[model samples]
Target: MAARVRRTTRHSSRFAAGSILIAAATFLPGAESAADAPGLEVPVDYTCRFPSGSHAMTAVITGSIPADGTAGRPVEPRDIALALELPAPAVAELAGLGAGSVSARADLTVVHTLGDETATANWSGLSASAQGITGQEQVTLHAEGSVPTATFGSAGTATLSASDLTLFLSPLQEDGSPTEPAAIEVECGLTDGSDGTLATVVVAEAEGEGEGEGAEAEPEKPVENGGTAEPEEAAPGAPRIEGRLPAGAREKLEAARQDVEALADGPDPCPFPPIPLPTPADTYVAGYTNVEKMDGAALLGPAHLNVTLMKEYIPDPCTSTFKVLSEAEFEYGGRRQLPPAQGTFLTYGFMPTTATMELIQVGGPAQIESVSVTSDPAMPEYTTVTAEFDLRIRDVEVNGVPLDVGAGCHTVKPIKQTLHAFGTGNPPSGYTVNRGGSMDGETYIPAFTGCGADEDVSSLLTSSISGGGNYIKITQAPLCVLNDTASVDCPAKKPTPER
Candidate 1:
């Protein structure tokens, strides 16, 4: 059977937990401040470009922001509530999509400026619950979610302004299955050419640190840009860890040292650095996994490689826009075919059956929709990365019998598979571009089509395999950096198959 996938960059990253404080400036009427200090209403007009057309919307953002904050501490927007009024035409468009109800999530980028330095945070994950669309009148969506925090290590006046706004819409039928298009993404910006300044916060130094006159003047400190600074030396109270010597550890360390020294003398294989920019950088990815069959049988032989020898682009940090410079080149000059997976399992709960399957690439190379990198100001060394992609699967067999699932046999719709990875300083958690990791998600196996060479058996396969929530897990090794050998050596290793 073949499965086709669709990939798009919806929202980038999830906000890491930190301190709390959120406020907004008023550009429209009905802006009010609560007696409780930073609680207020921020009204602004936005122009959102939908697939149908552009429409005007009025959004009232309600949140808490402190008037004064301490430096060296993180400040997160708290109790964020967004009340967006949708135009009638927008409602009609949803009705046209066969949507009885609609739900949405949104991301709004906030820019913070302190003196000449600037930082950014995403006020993301604002979600609105499902509500019926009558298509006769305007609809209102109330979205609320937590946002990422911003840290200021220096004392100054930090200005917060709104930048880009992205909306992800999910339309569903009465039975709860998604509509034909499934999801819709919309891009929005301020209606007028004005900087949507939400609020102004006065940042003061932390308590108990002061300088009196006649004391020697301290050196000028560097301005911070949403990141914290590490101390020059370890704290006296902090514990130090020392590992006991292990046998052969010294010899292994020496061998690794010699290999590094040899690479220093060798010519640099990569001509360019892997930086986040408009320019695309190509890297090779090799992955392996043990696919769990519907019969509770695990395909263990030949190692079901989800993606082998596939090329991907380095994600741009500032924005979510990217272009594929060119199609990936495999050893055969095109798509790389995975070796057929062979395994034996109980066919019908008791009958042991042997099967071989090939995972054919449905489209071209998997599309790298978006890449999001988030670092904690408290622990700057530890960072998290999230990436999304689209791929397809094809071909199946049982007892050496060809299922004959034609080329069109695939998932009825696109399913999203998200993978995450961590940085070097952090412990291994998820899939990272530099160090390969594991990815697990549920995918629906649609009913088989064009089966049976001698007699039709598509119904038998469909009855056994077609359904939602088929679990799949894939592990990837460090990518072979084709353009940057110093970072990652060429000829990436194939990961041992993971459940």
Candidate 2:
């Protein structure tokens, strides 16, 4: 299958949580603002939850004023960014479980009231580290752009805003594996600050079904921590889960079980079954001839010869035209042989007269090759000839392997054939034909002829070829013919005297 083309969209990594924080702090408030007034400090907390009945985890981000303590006067709007890193194993596990590529979208919104109006921006499409996340991961958030002074009141008061972000988990591996998380970093500060702090989280351990449970399941040894009595063992004859079958059924079951046990213990010779081989030849016939000549005059012979043959014999001053139409049909017994390897079959049918000849090649291994044609002697339109070629194969094989030749086995490799045209006038450009003989003023012979001038002939060749074991029939009308004269010492049929 061809791979589908995907349109890629460009995204900004600068908006990545940490980068936003760094940029804001380094460029936001100037040196004057840092020394004049006390800056606002706000602490933010983040939490995440899984599906119902699952555990939830939270992380906190602490915000404070710079050492100068004067960075929050004449406040402007600020942009907050957050970055989360997850363990690699967790990411792989989730991916293995068939979660699609994971992406984060902000579900939280913050509202601030300045002196008069308010503004808002939706934060979405959070990016994560492409690698290194294996176990518990950490995420970072940055808030530095701007917040209304009225919303938070004073730097002493805490301005709280919560966002319920959704983490989309998608499988990254073809064979579903859970994704892993390594660590997360959150950065937050005033719109104008120098730099931001970096934090890290370490994954303690990983536990799941793939891990060995037996080794981890050691029995808790009794200790001096308020233990009372030792567990007593039950009597030897106490009822237990001995079996689940009744006495009579158990007897028969035991007998069958014994037979299976015997077979397993007694087998020495290889028990594999014999493999079947394909037949070399499905069917072969003795008499398969395509052409025969009689008394210097060619007639439709054995083998299928379905083609249009046109001949013109021009004596001293008179031109005599001859035309012959023929078709062949083979009644197959369904006992057909295919080659060792699967391949396309090309069958050719030839028809020739003393002056003209035509050859037609169709696809597939089937019965009929060509059919239905219309031709005329005068007003010849010989520019282009078109013909429909049909293909059919009763049976075929590839590499000695039998193929199912049906609608279901429609896959076919490309095939091409060069049709040879012999005995004719100049064929159209790109066509080669054998030319010979001379009579009257000019001599011309055409070997290859295609459909010309007739509706039935044109339609048949223009239609799409059908597949399957069905017969393929093509109709072609060749317009070019040879002009030649030969003397024969034979008497012409006498015309009866007019009464």
Candidate 3:
């Protein structure tokens, strides 16, 4: 039997009670407060998906924490209610096990930033109510539980998907060794304890069941632990768990893990350092960022724009006018709100796109006001994100040609154009926005390079920026995933995926 949970410091290295038995010990990540700013309140909208042939569940994410910019607080789930649906075959198999009906009870990890590392808390309020036997059995599951109120060590976010949710039963260690602490045993009698009957699942030991065909049929394992149910052995490699799993249940488990839906937007988030311009609000939202430096020491291609400073006359500069803080990645496919600007400035040749940005870099305060992300009708599996941005670049250095605003030849007027960019995201993150074609059309200061009298760079801006067909592709420098909030070697996704 698992020991009763002993609540410890919120920043402790281990989980409570039954979780302790599993040894899910993790380190806490910390969040730095940005000017006692009001905590961020990000709305949650997520969906939990199972691999092919399984089902999906949707939930909302809500959180709060004080920071200067976007991300800076622990995100708590207002609730986590889901219905686990099984495939028809699994249902049929359940009937064979003499079980007229079955239900699933699993846990989802509430992920958040703690101290200086990623921390996870196991949430297990999953409840299931019998939905009347419809067809035959494998294991048609349903959940009717809610998440408990909790907080992370620091202010941040968390997300739930099949990969990040659902409890895994270990029958053995990765090296095929017996799992530590051993598996728990329970007896599922033929009748409920009441009525003078006790029906509880029991763990049965047997000779190893080889992996190939002609192998003994896997048992019919029902989802373990529902509302009020105690922890049961579920991890696959542990020691063959005796449950409601059907013969060949191993394949079934692997299959379910494959087809997961991107999570819905909640409080969960990730990366990128903000432009260094001083700002008011000190809040920073979590998400991913990918920055690529130009070969000729400029910002070009990858994100769909080529910026090479007129080196002979000026210096190389790079900048992006797309701000998508509150936007959803692979999860919710559609429009989203931009992160509020804590501090924005219109800098020139003076700042680097990232802390490590060395080549040509330049840009001013810009916003993505609003964006629309959808899937391609043809591929359906791919995500398509489009932005309507307004640019207000004041004196951007090109090839070192000083953006002399009122100068005769280089009468560079601030750029204020509405350019459109669309790109296909690689599976997970859902973004590969670029320059001119259907994919890489960046904004170019065409028609007039120097001065122009019309511009509106307000809350956000969008414009196709490029080096006037000078998509000078060259050997570039390695990308960097710099992060100041976490300890050295901490994970990063901003500007790019931090290794």
Instruction: Kindly report which residue stretches of model 1 are placed more than 4 angstroms away from their true locations once superposed.
Output: 1-36, 208-499
Candidates sorted by TM-score, descending order?
Answer: 1, 3, 2
Q: Pairing residues by index, what is the TM-score of model 3?
A: 0.22
State residue 161's C-alpha deviation in candidate 2, in Å.
3.0
RMSD values, in order shown? 21.3, 38.7, 26.5
Candidate 3 lDDT over 1-499, as tens digits, reads: 1111221111111222210111111111222222243432222222333222233232322222232212212122322354444445434433333443333345544443322233234444253433333453433344544332223221222222222344221122233222342211111111212121101111111235332212222232333222121223323322121111122223322332232222223333332343332211111112111111121223221221211111111111211112332111111113122222121122232332211111111233223221223332211111122233322234434334433322222212332322222222221111222111111222343222433234332111122222333221111111112323232111111121111
Best by the lDDT measure = 1
Tens digit per residue, CA lDDT, model 1, 278-332: 3223333333332234445333222222322224344332322221122322222
The lDDT of model 1 is 0.49
Residue 368 in candidate 3 has what lDDT? 24
lDDT of each: 0.49, 0.23, 0.25
TM-score against truth, every candidate: 0.43, 0.21, 0.22
Q: Lowest summed-lDDT stretch of 10 residues in model 1? A: 238-247
Worst 10 residues of 2 by lDDT: 489-498
**Candidate 3 RMSD computed on C-alpha atoms after optimal superposition onto the true structure:** 26.5
Q: Please count the clashing residue pairs in each candidate, in the order shown.
A: 7, 74, 128
